[model samples]
Target: MADDGLDPRRWAALALLCAANFMVILDSQIVLLALPSIERDLGFSGGGAQWVLSAYLLGFGGLMLLGGRTADLVGRRRTFLAGTTLFLVSSLLCGFAWTGGVLVGARVAQGISAALMAPSALSVVTAMFAEGTERNKALAIWSSVGGFGATAALLVGGTLTDALGWPWVFFLNVPVAMVLLALGPVLLSESRGRARAYDPVGALTVTLAVSAAVYGVVRAPETGWTSASTLGALGVAVVAGAVFVRVETRSAAPLVPLQIFRSRRLTGGNLVMLLTAVGAFGTSLAVSQYAQGVLGYSPLEFGLATAVLPVMAVVGSYAAQAMIGRVDVRPVAMTGMAFMAAGCLALGQVSENSGYVTGLLPGLFLFGLGLGSSAVAAAVAALSGATERDSGLASGLNTAAFQLGGALGVAVASTVAVSRAGAVPGFRAAFDTSAGIALAGVAIAGLLLARPRRRRVPEPVGVTMSKEESTCGT
Candidate 1:
């Protein structure tokens, strides 16, 4: 790589940060693909097993802004170390878990830790690298690794489940987390957002509100929406949500500036991601189950099957890197999102009796291709206009949006599946419905993402102040 005003130390630091982020995303789906085996071994019923996946999404998504805000307030490097420590400890406990409850609890712990890691990781990269190529290169690599982790999770999880048992999937994080944690203190420089002061109330209320809402969504399929449990959760969500807004409006140091919504680009990218993720993550889980249960694939077979995603996404990520300099993200993202919708739509047509070779493989390939390219493009689009100070919060918000979308997708799909009464047909109908949802994301990505008449650079602007403490511009 050319100097581009970037130091080798900066790239080295970003590599470690990307590794940590990859560890978090990879574990999320890998566990899902490995779930059936884990459930059988632990003697957990199907619904009980859902918590293992749902809990992680809930925790990670809920506290994401808090994590980012803390990074800005405390110091990005400190937050990264703290998050990594918790993630490592939680991973160990998860591996040692003897009961379903224990595993689910540990997964939530891991997610909370990940919330801390997520924002710190990206924000640090932005601080280290100057805006333009140096920054874009680092972010491209970071986002690419994220896509790679998600795709590779299923395959690696499947293999671990087959060869080493499900415990190894959790245990797998131990080495990676340790390595990243060790590298961080040595390789990373200490830095915090230039903004002074902090908002504990803003962070706390928003975290509680989002968690409550996602919890309601995740649990709704198991508890009928009309039931007291569901109704109570919804009520909690409403109150928390309202309180969160009120606090932010009044807080001296707001967790997130409500004005970010003013950017049509940011909102459009977020909505597209929300829908795309709902389909992609939901499909990843649903298909993993279908392959093992319906197709009678062993864990090893299942892992190998999902290898397609990582491979295709890596290719797509690289392609996006090349195009980022030449093309507006709008066209690239829209194209990828369209492909994703088409891929899902194709998958929806698969018959119950269809074979992997004849029916599932084709759609999987296209879906994987779309997921790989669009994810990178969409991420860049979402965070494009952000300053280095708020990059962490931006990344955190993007992550939470995706996870929340997935959680909702899982709940909706599970509800549709359950209401369909049986597993196979239920899976089919739910997946088909998800496909339609994904297509809607395609249209949004296409119609809403702003375009420039020519290859253009983002408008130069001052870095926004964090916590409303002080003014900042880059």
Candidate 2:
């Protein structure tokens, strides 16, 4: 470590971390294109095949907070290595599964491993870089890499499934996980929180609550929002959430410290993240359905056509990081949301006979820009105020907000799309809904983040660095 407490190998550590992050995120969606192949090969009946996807989502979304807290308690490097090993084993198991049930089981294990890796890797990144421009740039790269992973999944999944069969999708992770496991111990340092109280009660309740909520949301569209199973799952989530709150209030060492919520930027950043995911994921679903279903494009063609989104997102991430250094996070985030809304509105106008250039490219371009920019801004806002001790918890909260928001987005959009009169009309309605969500994000950013102004003087004597420069780079 340097005099500034920056890790000497921070950049290399970041690359390893981002690679792990990308692999886990890639697995999340890579299986989407392979679902049909999986179903046919494993003799899945009816909608049972969807479980291969849902099982992973439930485990990942549900266990993320626990996983992050675990990193803080057990040591980030250790947790990361353990997670990678499990992920490797799970991926191998998924590739070799002879039955649909076995594949789904392996997928759940993969999700668990992802839950461990994501926050731990992120917290490590936050720990390695000091909270300023360096961290901001690192996060920009991190956000852009995640965007690429999601987009790559669509393209890679199709190609791999077509060429090498669907199992290759799972097999792809084996090599990546092996490399991470090999390099992790060498590149990363061990770090854990001072507090040692496990708070098992709080942990259990929060996990149950989040898991149940994710389960309810993901299943709502298929099971019907009013269905007993859906209502029951949501009810369990509510009750568990209530219990978790109560437990945290009285626990000697809380799973999530309630005091952390006092940070206005942290709270607001999380809300922005949630709403951003709502717009990003929901609108992507709408666009993908429109391109492939109505436009008569094959899976590969659809992926290639929509590739512009991730490319522009990469541009936007770097641009937003640069902009944030000059101004408050508010303007950049609000502008990003505005762009997203505009993109959604444009896509909403798509017709049955619309072409890619005239209909899809423009909207995707704007949405991608917004997606990348807003993501960086939100992450910066959420993580900047965190003390080193609470870094993992903060990272977990941010990641959980995103995962939950994505689940909500996909559910709401699917519900709206299916309830409409026709395919085109349904997709249009979904896009419009996504635009509304983006607009809501704009309002949240404006209200929560500081207004733009010229650079102010440095902090007064005795003030800490973290408290003085709280609003991302502002």
Score every model by TM-score.
0.90, 0.95
Q: Residue 13 of candidate 1: its Cα lDDT?
A: 84
Alpha carbon lDDT of residue 251, candidate 2? 87
State model 1's lDDT: 0.76
Candidate 2 local lDDT, 378-423, one digit each (tens): 9998888777787888888988888788788878999999999999
Q: Where's the lowest-lDDT run of ten residues in candidate 2?
A: 462-471
Q: Over the stretch 1-474, how does candidate 1's per-residue lDDT look in tens digits?
A: 236555568878887888998998887677876677778888898568878888898889889888887887788899999999999999999999989889999999999998999888888877777755556667678877887787678788877877888899898899988898778888987777667577777777788788888888888888876778878877887887788788877866677876665555566777877776787777776776677777787767877776776677777767776786787677777777766766767666666687877767877787777776677777766776566667777777777777778788777877776677667877777778777786677777776566523323444343342222122111
TM-score winner among the candidates? 2
- In candidate 1, how many clashes are counted? 3
Q: Candidate 2 versus the native: TM-score?
A: 0.95
